[model samples]
Target: MNTDSTRRWLALGALAVAMLTIGLDMTVLTVALPTLAVDLNANNGALQWFSTSYTLALAAVMLPAGALGDRYGRKKILLAALVLFGVASLACAFAATAGQLIAARVVLGVAAAAMMPLSLAVLPVLFASPVERARATNIWITSTALGLPLGPILGGWLIDNFWWGSVFLINVPMVVLGAVAVAGLVPESRNPDLRPLDLPGTVLSVVGMLGVTYGFIRLGDEGWGNGLGWGALIAGAIVLMLFLGWQRRTAFPLIDLGLFASRGFRWGAVFAVLITFGLFGLFFTVPQYYQAVLGTDALGSGLRLLPMIGGLLVGSRLGDRLLPKLGARLMVAAGLVALALGLGLGALTSIGTEYWFTAVWIGLVGAGMGLGLPVSMAVAMDDLEVARAGMGSALLQALRQAAGTIAVALLGTVLATVYRSELGDLNVDPINDSVNSGVAVAKSTGEAGMLEHVQSAFVSGMGAMLWVCAAISAVAVALALWVLPRRSAAVGADEAVPAVFADVDAPESTHVG
Candidate 1:
């Protein structure tokens, strides 16, 4: 390979590292939450805030961060985000109160917002060849996937061996390494043709997304009828409608809604949401099942999730290879079918279900996800002109984050409602609130039957949630067939052209610093 080719691949490795760290951060906090509650003397509300703050902050900043990267330089924004993430990680490690930790988490979220979009946007610039880009995309997807499983294991280990704060501290060295590698390897790239920033559109988009996302999260935490949740949800919806109207009329819109004109881009974004929607539902329900029903510790629960991760890895490899021959429509449709089947099987889970049975179905879910999500992402990215890569990717990511938040909230509500109904006037508010609390109450009362009943109730709720997931996957299958391209010829013809990515067709900037 030529020297330039080698450098690009090396740059990809650095970028992948950034993706891994960011992905790990997303899920790692879950395993640490219970521990943080005890250590920080945090109330239940504070515990929830620790997670929600990060998510809300991340959602709020995605579009603006992407625009900034496009206007200034992606590599520069990414490097700065890394430093900020590292510093925030340190701040989290030393935080003395629940409020302080939540604040630190918000900062971490902002840093991640900057990193996430630009990281994906940089890929087309580095791997101009479609074949190479697909391979790189698989690695990129895998790196991020690795973190989801690894976070629980890593966080569980640290919490077991040291203070809860160790979990946040662990990110410090990794971020430092990623920052240095990115600085040395990744090339700075941006859109020269970008219009001046649209301040009004920016405010509307940020507030609109933040409000909608915050409402969903609040719905999960406080319930659907919560005044704050309903208020924010309505306000967000109205503002978002206004944002859309503004985008159409603005001189320099934050996002060019015209990108959605491409059927592939629109459908690809839909597929992205559907894939994560299923996965997030599992992520929300499974660990509690392990710890509350199966009587496992956090470490054991993390280990149990390994099969799902393993299946995802295998499926991703298959999807990467199959996508070229099968095309977007058939491959993605088949994937949604597999995903639905997996979730359908999972929906049958009962308290008496065997671990092997659970593993098999969950693994299928993982495989479907592996097969589906990355290819959908590639489909979306394929439509992007390099000049618009950051904005396009940001829109996709924002949609995905919003989808996940909504899916989890919806599923959480299902679980909560069913669990409460199944508990049936136990008159113990504590027992009615959560499975863990139910378990604790059972143990405190020395009622093995009560524990049994609680486990059965929780499993029933989980089954209901899984059925919801199956329904979603079924819908995704229909959408895939309806919206995705039916023939490879539609996209393959332009796969290798340098001009397919704008920067590759343009002269390199001699002034790149």
Candidate 2:
């Protein structure tokens, strides 16, 4: 291989390592939340804020960060964001109060927002060949994805042996390594045209996302009847509509709406969002089932998730092999079918259901995610021009992030509402609040039948939520078959270009730092 070819692969390795940290951050906190509540003397409200703050900041800053990377330099912005992410991790580690931790989490979110898009933006700059790009994209995606299951396992072990701060502190070394590697390996790249920032559009987008994200979070916590949640949801929708209108009129828009004109980009993005909805729903429900119902500690709960990871690895390998022959439409449809079948089986879970049964179904769900997610992402990205890579990727990430937040909220509501209804007029307000609270109350009071009631109620609720997820996956399968293109644009383009010089200079090139 040529020297330039080696350099591009090495650069992808650095970016993948950096992306691992962002993925770790996404789910690591889940295992740490119960511990944080005890250590920080936090209430349920504060516990929710810890996560909500991060989601809000991440959703708000992503679009603007993408525009900045396109206007300035992607590599420079990525490096800066990495440094800030490390700093925020340190701050979160030593935070003295709930409010301080929440504040630190918001800063972490902003840094992550910048990192996610710019890392993806560099892929087209490094590899021009469709085959090489697909391979690179898979590696990039797997690095980010592996961290999701790893988060619970790693966080659980750290919390068991070390203090809660270790979870946050763990990010420091990874961040430093990723930053150094990125600086040495990745070339600087940005749009040569240097479009002006859309300040009005930026404000509207941020406000709209904040409102909509926070609204769902509040509704999930307080129930669907919450007045504040309804108000925020309505207001955010109106603001987002205005933002869309502004984008149509603005000379230099934050996102290029024209990109969605490509059927590949539009359907790929839609399928990706649908998959995220189911994926996050699994993450949301399963950990609690492990901890509360199965009577396991955090470490045990995390260890139990290994089957899903195993399934994911198998699925990804199959997707990489099959995508070329079967094409995106068929491969993605097969993936969604696997996903739905797994969720459908998971809906059969009961209080007495065996661990092996749970493992089989969750593994299938993971496999489905592995197969569908990368192909969908690759299809969407295949349509982007090199100049718009940063903004376009940002738009896709923003939508996926929004979908994840909604999944957690909507699924949580389904679980909570069903759980409460099953318990029926329990005089204990704490028992009515959640299964965790009910479990705590039953144990403290040594109330007969209360523990049984809570466990059964929770399992029933979980089954209902899984059913909902299965239905959604079924819908995605239909859409994939109906809407997705028969083949990727990359495969078609690859027919004309030789593989060896795919990374060589094209008409457009990124300015090397």
Local error of candidate 1 at residue 431 (angstroms):
3.4
Predicted structure with the largest lDDT when compared to the true one: 2
Question: Lowest lDDT 10-mer window, candidate 1?
Answer: 498-507
lDDT tens digits by residue: candidate 1, 107-222: 99889878777777777777778789777766666566567778888877887788878888888887887888788877778878675878888788778866776676566556
Clashing pairs in 2: none
| Model 2 agreement with the true structure over 1-513: per-residue lDDT tens digits | 223988889889988888888778877877776667567866444555676677667766777776688788998998999999999999999999988998999999899888877787788778878789878866776687667778889988998899989999989999898899889888888877677889999899888876776677667657789999889988988999999999999998877789898777888788888887777778767877887788877788788888887887788777777778888898789889999999999999987899999999999998887778767876777777776554555677677776776676667777877887788766357676566777777888898588888888988989999999999999889889998888774743222121111110111122211
Return the TM-score for candidate 2, rounded to 2 decimals: 0.85
Q: What is the lDDT of residue 277 in candidate 2?
A: 75
Error of 2 at 327 (Å): 3.0
Candidate 2 positional error at 61, Å:
2.1
Q: Candidate 1: what lDDT?
A: 0.73
Q: Determine which window of 10 residues in candidate 2 has minimal summed lDDT.
A: 499-508
